[model samples]
Target chain A: MNIPMSEPITYLEAIRHAQTDCLHTDERVFIYGEDVEDPLGGAFKATKGLSTRYPERVLNAPISEDAIAGMAVGAALDGMRPIIEFQFADFAILAFNQLANHAGAGAWRHGQPCPLVARLPVGGTPGGGPFHSQMVENWLTTPPGLISVAPATVSDAYHMLKQAVRCDDPVMFYEHKALYFHQRASLSNAPEYPLGRAVVRRQGQDISLVSYSAMVWDALSAAEQLARDYQIEAEVIDLRCLKPLDMNTLYDSLEHTGRLLVCTEAWPYAGVSAEVIAQVSSQAFHLLDAPPRRLNAKDVPVPFHPHLWNAYRPNTADIVQAALDLVRF
Target chain B: MQKIPILLPRLGEAVAEATVQTWLCQSGDTVAKDQDLLEVETEKSIIAIPAPAAGVLLDIDKPAGSRCQVNEVLAWLHSNESDVVQPVDSGSPHAAPTPTETSPTHTPTASLASNSGRHGFLSPRLRALMQEQGLTELDLHLLRGSGQHGRIKADDLTQLLEHLQSHYEPHPAGMLRQAVADSMSRSWNRPLATVSSAVKMDALLAHRKTLPERPSASVYALSTLAQALKEDGRIAKLLLGDQLWQAQQIDLALAIDVDNGIYNPVIQSVDAYSLGELAVEVKRLIAQAHERQLPSNGHNTGIATVSNYGSLGITWATPLPPPGHSCLLGLGAVRRQPDWHPATQSWQCIRACEITLTFDHRIADGGTAARLIHRIVHLLEHPDLLS
Candidate 1:
């Protein structure tokens, strides 16, 4: 069902466009998840127009991540591309079982791929307390077999989501709520996103700051802020695909900067942050002047209040500060 | 004055054309002779071309990023004064009107070798092959080109150069090379001689097996050997300069050759690594050596070297004294053999190994080396110190 040649879209509009456009492009591509229908159209507005355009293709399922993941896997196995949305980022925990154990490893170990996209809404804003505001791109990228992607722009959401669906491997496609309304790039059409790839949002050399999900925008903000305040240039790498990470971009950037600072909302230990640091150090050890530093969530759970949450998570200021420390080191 | 068309200088031999990357010096900039005026790149490397004369740049003939040749005019310069450096009648490769011997002008006497030198029409296939591997002038000269006029076409050099540079070439010298060069020369020049000793290593083996493995446990026969060698006052002071000078530290490099050039990884402080540690260290070093896992570890220099060829079934072979450290005690393969001693009065099968000491002749005479080897043998024979 091709999108009715329609008007230009806002961030929300582009999201709706992403689902419908995808449904039109690949016959194998379909949408699923709880409340993903004409009446509700997903917890977020992403599937608003998709269910109407492709009735048979767009599906509604019970609130079970495992069942959702299993169905997508089965669909992919029988030759259909399926995309399922979690109501919120924290809801992804329900599906982590199938994703981490089965969907994530099947393509790599068994050589039988499970092509699926798990769209998740994440990031804290508009008083989204602990449960709804959680950013779990970090949790998803920990497994080396699967890819976790976060797009900060509507174009990215549209193009990357479609690209994620068509991929032969599973992708935890994260949509940052803060960026779903704010981010704008010099993009005409949504880009043809490449899975397991990284893109540099800004070109720089003094320090390399890698971030994803909501923090990606925060890193870019920190880059601009640092550029203005202390004249320290920061290359903000939007780590689009977390696993099968485009390590080459990080290495190439680190080769010039010789310093790395990763910004994420994940906890510090044995988390996504650790993998990024390890990968950078191993692949680019000779290039690095010091070990990579991270401005991740503290070794605690996300807080409830605004002030507590702000202190718990890394913000633009935290990213900028970490970037400054990297160059100094 | 003379009118000379200055051609572009060739960068690395791989360059076909250069996009004048940057002009460092501006027109009218007073540049001393040999001062770089511009940086140019030909895909691979960026090189800054130095000014040929001390003068004020008069004109920039080539624009930045323009593609040009090795004899093309880059810029013109005016020196302070002109003199008869060369006779006016000695017509050289220049366009001159005044016929002054030297008018502060750079005139070319030999025309730039153009597409004329190796003008064989390379086949499309050969050209592609040459373009892929990024060969250079030195490479072209090395290749036995079957193309026209013996010019190396793409295909002629591709398969062979790839095989030579990547597959057939020796892996490069690591940090160990410096130590080896230093030690070997020092030992070779020194007035050195060896003292061979046949000792039973059964006690050492038995002690090693008996120890309840612990990290803090004492180092086995090796430490005993080191301590006994220390008894000789001169043995510890200096090793063959060949072993010492070339490498950085006094770190001992034990030769555990695994048939690869860059495989050797020194056990940081062999004396400090105890018997359990020694076994672990040796095993780790050997595994890394064999699997090529010990990477970039040999930055520190080795003071002396020991080749325990005997442990690995090779017996009684002379070892090269590494460049930094002078003396190496080569041990023969330890195996069960019948040994006869005057005290025993009868032949008995025992575990025995022979040690051959190769020392620098220039630094130490035969007596010192003999004394050193004897001390080492004493420690090796008595495993109590190691235990």
Candidate 2:
């Protein structure tokens, strides 16, 4: 069913709709996580009415994240699609062995695809401390067989979630908690580009600003300010899929603007931002007029206080300063 | 009293940091605004940091020999006047005083010179473009780069090519003109000086009229210059670093004005030939230069050059010597001027012209140049000696 165009759909609603659509069409699909059953829904109310509508498919699990992931992997291997939800991205580490070793490498080792979707509530919020807010894409992406995607727009949140449910390989869907309510867009039924491709959120000429998830919004804002204040036009790219990075799109944008600045909400060390910069520096060195630079969240745990959290993550001002440095360089 | 920060202003585009060499004033010293507070040495030059406002220097944050980045606070000042301190924005780190607002006195040092004539860094894209266009470092040096530290960025190169594409129609300079331009640009790097003296050519003109084969004034001047160099061959030496290379022959090049360009084909051993033979050789060289048939072998290497710009009706001109040469002799147009003979007590019109000698000043000084011109003028005045 098409949602009414009169009201804009938020990132969280689009994700709920995508799961509902999957459950209605595909009988083999089911969602399993902590407190996800009826009356309680999920922690963030993402599966509010889903348990009541499809009681057999939506089941509640104990607080054992490892057991929850292990059961999903077993169900996926037995020709069933299982969607697992981690209360917060920081708690996903307890299931790292099952997600990375078993489900991720199952297709290559046993010639059987583990069609599992892990809905991770990632990124920072006002008071989500170190244990609640964390971007786990960098950890999940390092494994060989996982497909990690962070959707920034409501359209991608609606479409990519369904695409991940259909894919034979296991997918790590990192949905930014901050963008859940704040970001909204008109739900479009138009055909979507396949997963693992980047989208240019804004077109520019002076510099290329590459980011993903919630940082994509900040990059767009920074690009606007750069054009308005410094007369620097910054091209913004949202890397929808972090694992299968669309380097060709980056190369094309970098060819137009010889400068590049990447921003990420994750910490700086061995993360998505680092990977993007390293790839461009090695493969597309000739296209760069200035040294490629990246701005990441401060190398610290997600802060507890609101003011500290504001300073912990990379913001629009930081992005603008980084873009200015690259453009002026 | 309030404390104010004295920031290190930006030195240049390419200079990122500088070393605090010496402090002109100690702590507790009352300094005036714009007074030199300290000296810092950057990669480009030595610059003096000035006091932002008149105040007592509280203390130095960065001591001597310590390096600091641009806009870093060097020291603090305690001032009674609160208005003297400009309020800094705490919200934005980039909202600091610009270079113009904190005008530091820049004094360029001889230690770190500019890289105008020298080849600096070339970006990979710029290198590829240069290779594609068949351009060398000399051609690259001709372009003024707007990049950091005066580096020629690929954008600068492309912009220049685009400008040329839109603004001007390009015509290929053929082999002859290209060779001349290349050599002249190389020769222009030398410290060249020119000296000119008036010469009465009436005797030389009359002597030429008496001969069966009359030589042109350029031929006569060339012969005289060659003879004078033969007398003092030390003046024709080339200064190569700490040593001087002596010439093997007194060969001279005759500047021939061809269509669209000039050619200086060497006429070998001018002093060894008589006036008639020298005149014949000069005519043949001029014809060969006009037809662009001058030999490419070492026949172009000469000790000096003679340019007869007077043939084009120029009264006076200083012609430059070509590469591999030490000096150039230029002949000016002949003009009649009244001369007074004290014994006769009357003025009589006489034929006269100015002869200029342009030489590499590094090889010889002005006294030697003056003496050489004097010798050539003496020979030209006594036409019998030239014959």
Candidate 3:
């Protein structure tokens, strides 16, 4: 199947295309999640019209997230690839025991590969409130033996999801809801870069702005503003995979620019941004000219009002200010 | 009113006690925040202690001329608010305290203490770069940092190196030049002083003419200084920490100018050799130094060094001693001067030159240095004693 290179595709279309390709290539692959069947499709319309194409594989599950994740783990162990989708990332917390204890440690303890992918819609929209908008990638990534990935670009969104389906281990795929219809990119025949490798979205020298998911866009915009206003060139790195963190890419960028600033939309306490800083400070201590810092969302529940949510989440302006302070430092 | 103590901040790493120089504001005067309350003199410089907060100068605990240690309260200020009297610029030694509030919009202050290069708060990357390039903190004193509070950042060092590379062509110093530089830099750590006096060289010139083979003026001065050191070895004592180590032999080194740099070749026991033997030895060493063939371990154990800078047409010089040595004796160019003979009521031309002795002041005082230089001048004037 060839995706048209002439027209741009949204991040949501990239995920659907990836799932369609997986179902077409492999007969044993199936997707099981709440409201994923025909007509209604998934919660974000990611699986729209998929049930008509592959009716046997595209099936809906009961509304229990725990039962849905547990069934996927059992099916993966029984020699079938299964993909589970949570309507929102916040609901994935209900399946924590099944994902972390059963599927996460399946291969290590039982010596059998658990080829399952849990697609979680993460990050905020204008009125996502507390339940539908939380970024649960940090909690999913903390458990060992699980590969967690948050793709920011349309190409990575298409390529990395296909890679995750093929991977022998279980993978948690975090798709940013806010970027579904907002970001668009034309498909290319570029070879898929291996997972666990970070790409430099922009080349710079003054500081390294490391981020992933929706925060990568904010970091890129902040880099542009820094270059235009302060003459500070900020290198932006997109960490497509979070579990097997590509520290080498971060270290390489830090070698040129001794300052580092990590941005994430999650809360600060023990979040992905904090983990990045802790690892960089320990392993790449000598590469740092200034102390490595992180910019995270305010330590509060996702606000309901649009203006409150705007201030609660880390945005382009927050990233710009953090980068400037790091550059000056 | 809340009484806030104005403590003396740490001036520098080694400074302990400081003398209160003058009080800028009296006890009853009301001072604003950051206003100079008093000036204190440390060994490094005079620093003014500022009011930590806007208040009245309630009392002067340590008045002018009273010495105080670090963290000691020099005075007390009566502030209006008790809860908000935060110590501003508290850790920085020289910066005056200014009232600053922590606002939500302001950038959070970095947790690392801000320090200048001299304070030695070096980052790991900066330290690694310095180690790779064979540089110490003292060697990079001139590099100004753009980091917080004027701390030297790693980029500043790399930028300095890059600026040097683009602006100038670098030629790696030869081993001999590097050795000399290392020795001179180590010797410069001590407090060194030079004393000079003029010696009439007419007798020495006349005496050398009587001998079968004439010795160079440097060899004569080397021999004279060796004899004076042998008479009082205290003048050549090497100060190691608080103890002085006296030499067992009166060995001296002769500074010979080579192709790119100077070599100081040691002549063991100069008092043991006669004038003719010493002249031949000095000639051999000079030839070997010019050819860069001096034995590696043969030059560094001398107790003192004698430099004949007069050979370069220099009239007088205060040359530094080599590392591990305590003193250096330098001989200047000889000049023919008109002298009046009062006993015969006549004027005559005489040959005279200046002799300078540079000594490490940690081992000897000015009187000791002056006496040693006077003895050298005496021996040079009476050349028969040198033989």
Number of the top-ranking candidate, with TM-score as the measure: 3
Q: After superposition, how far is residue A33 of candidate 3 from its true place, in Å?
A: 2.6
Q: Give the per-residue Cα lDDT of candidate 1 at A275.
A: 84
lDDT of 1 by residue, A87-192 (tens): 8879889888788888888777678888888888887774677688877866787775677777766667667877777778887887877776676443365466
* Candidate 3, superposed: residue stretches over 4 Å from native: A1-9, A38-40, A48-55, A62-64, A125-132, A184-193, A267-271, A274-288, A298-313, B1-10, B15-113, B119-167, B298-300, B340-342, B345-347
Model 3: how far residue A213 lies from native, Å: 0.8
* Alpha-carbon shift of residue B71 in model 3 (angstroms): 16
Give the lowest summed-lDDT range of ten residues in model 1 chain A: A1-10
Comparing candidate 2 with candidate 3, which one achieves the higher TM-score? Answer: 3
Scoring only the A-chain of each prediction against the true A-chain gives TM-scores of 0.91, 0.98, 0.98
**What value does the lDDT take at residue A322 in candidate 3?**
73
lDDT of each: 0.66, 0.83, 0.84
- Candidate 2 local lDDT, B1-387, one digit each (tens): 556778776688777789999999999999998899999999878999888778999879899999998656788887655344232211122333232243233212101112232443465556767888878777876675544334556677787889889999988988778888888999998999999999998999998888666889989988999899888876788887898999978888888899978887777788899998887887887778777787764744788999999899997997779977889999999999998979999999999999899989989899999999999999999978874
Candidates sorted by lDDT, best first: 3, 2, 1
Tell how far residue B199 is off in model 3, in angstroms. 1.5
In model 1, what is chain B's TM-score? 0.47
> Best to worst by TM-score, what's the order?
3, 2, 1
Interface RMSD for model 2 amounts to 8.3
